[model samples]
Structure formats: C-alpha cells, structure tokens
Target: MRKILVVGAGQSGLQLALGLQAHGYEVTLMSNRTADEIRYGRVMSTQCMFHTALQHERDLGLNFWESQAPRMAGIGVSVSGPGAERLVDWVGRLDGYAQSVDQRVKMAGWLDTFAQRGGQLVIHGAAVSDLDYFARVYDLVLVAAGKGELVSMFARDAARSPFTRPQRSLAAAYVHGLGPRPEHPDTEVARCNLVPGVGELLVTSTLTTSGRADLLFWEGVPGGPVDVFQGVTDPAEHLALTLDLMERFVPWEHARTSRVELTDAGGVLVGRYTPVVRQPVAHLPGGGLAFGVADVVVTNDPLTGQGANTASKCAAAYLRAILDHGDAEFDEAWMRRTFERFWAQTAGPATKWTNVMLGEPPEHVLTLIGAAGALPRVADRFANGFDDPADFENYFFEAEKTEAYLSEVAGG
Candidate 1:
C-alpha cells in the first residue's frame, strides 16, 4: 500500500484525501479536530458554489444535490447611483445549482465520507512540526491547509511573482434581521451600489433554507485608514453605524433585526479579517520531493468567490497527476505537473477576476448588462460558472463583452 498523508481537514484537503484513497492509496488524514469539535454554526458570509463545483460533486457520486442545495436561475443585479436604480435581470441559469452549505458542513461531510471509505482520520493535538518524518514514512505529503501558518513553509514572497502588487482590502460582517427577501425571482443575486467618486459597495442576499437571510456588504476604499472589519471601538456604536450605513446607501433586502426570531444578542457581530491580497506562493520548501497545493500556496480574493472552487480544481488535478505517476519517482513528476497545470488552466482566470474586482467598473459592464437583459441565452451561460469554465472565464472579462453587447443594443 502506498502511504500518503494529507494535512488540513478543509474542503480541499478532504477532497484530495477522498480522491487519493479511492484510487487504492493508503491515505492518513490528520487534523487537530475531532468529529464532535465540528460546529454547525453559520458562516459569516455565505458563498455560492458554482454549478461546475456541484456537478463535480455529483460526478464523484457525492450527495450534495439531494441535500436541498438551491439552484439559482439567474442574477437580478440592481445598480443604485445618483440617478435611480438601474435594475438588470441577467437570465443566467445553471446546469446544476450552486449549493450554499457552510464550509463546516461541506468539510465535515467530506471527512466523514472519507472515514467510511477506510481512510484514516487522526485528531492529533500537535502540529506536524517536521515534514521530514512524512518524507520517511509516506510516498507523499499534501498540504491543503488553506491560508494557515503552514503556508509559510513554502510561500513565495512578492519578489517571485510577475504581478507583485498588493491586493485590495475588504470588510465583511454577517448580520441577522437584515430584512425580508427582495421581490426578485432569482436567488444568488447581488446589488452593486456605486458611490460616484469614492468606491462601490456590493451586497448579496444569501439563500439559506432557514428563514434567516445572510447579509454581506463589500466596499472598496483608498489604501488609507480604512477599517476592513467594521472596526469600531464600541459594539453599540458599531451596530448603529452599520445599520445607519445600510439604510442610507445599501438598502438591505429586509428588516435589520425585526424579522428574525433568533435568540442571539443583537450586538453579536461577525467582523471580517484584514484584506491583504498576497501573491500565493508554491515553491517546494526543505528542498524535498514534496510540494504545496491550492490556496495554501495561492489564494484569490473572495470578491470573485472562487477560492474554494479553485482549490477543489487544483486538488482534482493534483490527484490525477499522483495516480498517473503511482509510487515510484512520484514527487518530482507531481510538482512539475502540479504547477504547470495550475498556472496554465486556473491561474489566469483567478488573476483576471481579482484584477477586475480591484479596479473600477469598466464601461463594458453597462453594455453587458443591457445585452444580458435582452438575451436570456447569454444570461444562462453567465450563471453556470462552476460547470462551464468558458462561461466563467467570460464573466471575469465582462468589460469587453459588455462593450460588444452595448453596440448591439445601440444598433437596435
């Protein structure tokens, strides 16, 4: 049996472990978490897993679909500005629905399933202080730790990347009692409030089976003294300021606290972490035969909501490379294929999306909006991002497409 050790119990790690064990490898999944340690609490910000990801789960025979994951038909985007609300209904539909299960459920499910498949799950309290041990014991060690401290082992500093510039900062809070749903028919919708010369704020209403709706607010600002986490000194002051800001500019879907009957205190706020977008590094540390995988090495900004999806894709690609090479001479071939495939297939798209979010809205956005409203086919392609890479790729470069669509609107 070929022994392989996977660190981290997140989605990417579980997916990689599951993929490897299924191929008859002796896999040991280690994390500092026990089954009971898993929490069912809701994540601060709800993210949409693209249809492609859902379809991938189905293809792997995972039961994500039967779990009541909502299939979002299209996105109803409302751009509020000085004039009025320019609402454009983009009729995009997914082949499979993007499920909004919290990261906890998603990770726990994958880990539990892996255990059932004869994979070992170790709940060790100590960190893996030495990679040398894994080098001696297993044929390989895969680090899917996301953005944990373990990344420092193999992180490539800014000096390495071609586009080595700092990333935009973000502040996100998960709040309850936001309000009732918008009158729009689609789920997974986002409202972009453009603040003329300052910056833009994008708010999305999270779709949960629970009556409680998840409210997410994202804003862009100059690299000065901006608190990315609603960083007010007093809790009372923070809640009041947030409520006031939402009412004045970003009209939330529903009431702030009146609608939900949750017992949690109104002052309970989930603030976002500082947004320091770094060039994700993946060089082999220790000069060993092993390498890092996915976000542990490279991470895209959450604005694109592509981090989990990108990590999963990388896991899939790495698994294939490992299986193809088998046990003998595995390390060298794996690293070469891993970096090559990631840079070629995924890196370009991730970078494109990140840059778009950081920069100002292009004129093409207006054009694409009008075109998508008039054409449902174009809209459908826009929504099925997880399954259709081509469509997903187009969404990142929407500025160009928007211009073309605008010309059509003008001619008509």
Candidate 2:
C-alpha cells in the first residue's frame, strides 16, 4: 500500500483521505481540531452541493445526512427593487437536487468516522517543519488545508488570480424557526436575493449540529452600506444586523424572518478574503515538495456558491490521478500536470464563472437572468448551470450568442 499524509480536515482533505483509505492506500489524516471542538465551533462555510459533488460523497459512503438534510429541489433568484419591490423574481427546478450540511457538523462527523474505520488520524496542527520531516517517510504529502501557515507556502499565480483584495465582506448566521418562502411554502429551496449595488444575500437550508436549520449569509460589497459588520462580536447583535439589513433592502425575505435567531452563541461568523489561485506545488526548506489541493490552489468567492463543490471535485480528481500513478514517483512535474488537467476540466469553468459574477455582471448576463423570469426553459437551464457551470460558457457570456440561444429555447 502506498503511504500518504493528507493535511487538513475540511471537505477536500477528508474526502481525499477517506477515498485513498478505501483503495487500500495507507493514509494518515491530520486535523487541527478534535471532533468535539469542531462540532461545537462557529459556523464556517455555506454550501449547497449540486448533484455531481454530492455524488462524489455518496460513492464514498460519506453522505450520512442525505435523507435528513433538506433537499434543495430548486434555486430562486430575487432582484430587489428600490425599497420593497421585487423587480425580478423567479425560481427554477434543478435537474437533480442539491444539499448543504454545515461544515461544523460535517467535518466533526467525518473525523470520527475515519477513526472508527481504523484509518490513521493525527489531531495535530501540522506546521511546515513537521510536514518537511514527513516528506521522506510518505509517498506523498498533500496540503489540503485552506488556511494557516501552510497555505501561504504556495506562491500566488498572479495571472490566474485577478483580485488583490476581498471583494465582499462576508457575514453568516444559522438559525431555526426561519419560515419558508410564502410563494413556495411546500418546497424547500435556496434563494439568492441580489441588490444591485449592495452585494447579495444567500438563504440556504442546511443540517446543523442541533437539527435542520436555515443559513442566512450576506456577501456585502466592501465599503458599501451592507459591509457594516466590522467588530460586532456578539452573535445576537450579528443576527440583529442581518435581519435589519434584510428588512431594509429585501423586505420580501425579511417578512418571514420574524422568529429567526442564532442556533448557538458561536453560530454567527464574520470575515472576508480575496479570491485567489496559487501555484499547485510548494517547496519546503528541506527540498521537500508539497502538493496543494482544492482551496490551496484555487479559491473563489462565495457569491457563486462553488467553494465546497469545487473542493469536492478537486479531491476526486487528485484521487484519480494518484491512483493512476501507482508506485510512480510523485514528482513536481506529476503534481503540476495533475492540477492542470483538473483546472482545465473542472475548476477553470467554476472559477471563470464566479470571477465574472463578482464584478458588475455584463448586460448580457442580466438580460439572460431577466428572461428567465418569463421563460421556464431558460430558467431551468440557468438553474442547472450551477450544477454544470460549463454550460454557461455556451450561452451566457456573449450578448449575441445569448440572444440566439434564447430564441432557440423560445422557439423550441
């Protein structure tokens, strides 16, 4: 069995480690926190895993909460009007459902699961010196950690990463007692409320540590009015600010949030980060090579809701490459080539789509979304594009092509 040391315990790290273990490879997974600590920790990320990413989990028997978690059958887009008007409101069915399981809940469960299954796990904070020492012992050392002293080792790919600063201030809170959209009371769905100059709000249903709950997340344009959560450390205060903004800008959404409150004292989180893409391989002081995975290589803003999905896909891709390279040296060339293939096939489209959405969307893009309000086919196609973002490249980016595609859909 090939020996592998996978650092970090987030979506990508755990997934890759579990996958390799199942394949008879000797894998040691390292996590910075214990399962209990993560379980009770602050809410970390907002995710709505579309069909493909979810399948990667199910195939590994890692989807323990599927039936319990709310099935996101569709995605709705609401463009807020000045004050209370909803200028454009439409929801479209996804070809296959999506789901969000809180990372706090997920990572904790996966950690325990890995240990129960007899996989080697080290609950230690792996620094560069530690990883450099392990380099000689393991066949491969994969750095899957998204943050910390480790991630900075990977040099920024300046050409690939366009943003020098965070585009949005991110605030999120999980709560129970949040009501469903009155328009679609029976069906569970994820909603994106867009306020032209103020950034966007994403309301997603997720399974939390206590039980099923709703996640209200804001991606506020920096220095804009919505970017107001700087030092409010109290969870109650954070939630109040979230609801207050919702009432002012997206009253239609706020109307149902009367009963919403924090799921825990640590339920609310506030932070911001630049969307970046870094070189795939990092060199250590001892001449050891560490292969970067997922967010370590490519980080996109949450505006597109692709972070967890991209991580899932990246882990799978790296797993496939590692399996194919049986007993071969995991040289720098091999690492670069593996990442290049994944970038071209999967991450590139997701990154390009997200980067495009972060700026003032092109006129063609707005026209396409507006048309979806009237055309079910257009809406469904647009909704499914979140599952397979490459589809957008075919019909979304160009005005002339978008018109032709819409005409085709309308005629058909």
Listed per candidate, the RMSD to the true structure in angstroms reads: 4.4, 0.9
lDDT per residue as tens, model 1, 1-412: 8888888877678778888887888999887675545534434234556655555556667645345544454444545555334454344565655555545456666777888888888876324455656666777877777555666666454533334444434544445455534555335544444443434444444433342344444454545223334455554454455445555554543233444332223322333333222333333434444467776666655655666676667777777778777656655555766666775687556655555655666766555645666776555555454344444454547556555544554566
Q: Quote each prediction's TM-score.
A: 0.79, 0.99
- As a whole number from 0 to 100, the lDDT of residue 369 in candidate 1 is 47
* lDDT (C-alpha) at residue 84 in model 1: 32
- TM-score of model 2 vs. true structure: 0.99
lDDT of 2: 0.92
As a TM-score, model 1 comes out at 0.79
Q: Which candidate gets the maximum TM-score versus the true structure?
A: 2
Lowest lDDT block of 10, candidate 1: 260-269
In model 1, state the lDDT of residue 96: 57
lDDT by residue (tens digit), candidate 2, 274-372: 999999999999999999999999999988899999999999999999999989999999999999999998899999999988899899889889999
Which regions of candidate 2 deviate over 4 angstroms? none
